[model samples]
Target: MADRELEEIGEDNTLLLVDDEEPFLKRLARAMEKRGFAVETAGSVAAGRAYATARPPAYAVVDLRLEDGSGLEVVETLRETRPDCRVVVLTGYGAIATAVAAVKIGAMDYLSKPADANDVTAALLAPAGDLPPPPENPMSADRVRWEHIQRVYELCDRNVSETARRLNMHRRTLQRILAKRSPR
Candidate 1:
């Protein structure tokens, strides 16, 4: 499927993948390579930016938050170097505002973390202005809520009170939720 999609796109197979998480970055790079992309990877925003400036790839998958700065900067550099680059912004912290900002900055799509190689490839090769097919297994509402809570908890440095305050949830309720296993 991926091979067919790549052939259909008929663009250069050069792809850049940037992520702060080394393991995920490596895994994704390998997966993309198997799917026919000549993958290059960066573990930081500065490196990603430099790579984009040096040689903008036909496609890019960049994590939104990096140790040094936002991955949007890399997208900007890629756009400047090659306006035709198809960039996908990936992040663990998915939010409406960030998604909008990514699109506005030249990203072709936005995906949350844990997205598989197939999904990434689909997004990269989908024709312009076409909506992606629905997920094979969409997260349940409970799982979505749990994910949002966990993201907020981490953002607040795992302070139960702070997370609850930001979420407008009762401290005890938030504690209870945090104590339980995540929903499927």
Candidate 2:
């Protein structure tokens, strides 16, 4: 897809991000920057619209609810002013009706919160209806340890030692599973 919105807009690959949740904004902003995007953020739909009016971005990630106003307003404005811009709507409270409405109006895709960088990247760059291939399900690691670790990981937000104790296994075993998932 043409990442640039229009012929004259230039290929800055700038992103306009709108979200009311502060922590998610901070984390996602850093993640997007690491992936090589120029990001600008707004806490409200009105502010986002103002920013978009002043300097349009190639892509926008908008939250469905904002402290000041509904994100739908920003999405609508972006669709009107920057017709070629790729727009992704985000909702902490994901509902089928809202997703359908976003698609009908102009958003390229809709995603729920806590989505990782890969999800955002695919939404921003992939062909509208095409999702990336699922990762291979390798069964090399036994499920007993994996599930035990996973249960405690969820309880501790992936903290290793705590998960190990909760699972009654050595912390090193949990670390090994994590290391296996990461690059060498």
Go through the candidates in order and give each one's C-alpha lDDT. 0.90, 0.77
Off by over 4 Å in 1: 1-3, 9-11
lDDT of 1 by residue, 66-166 (tens): 98888999999999999999999998777888999999998989988779998999899888999988888777889889888998998898999999999
Clash count of each predicted structure: 0, 0
Per-residue lDDT for 3 in model 2? 41
> What pairs collide in candidate 1?
none
> What lDDT is reached at residue 7 by model 1?
84
lDDT at 26, model 2: 85
Best by lDDT: 1
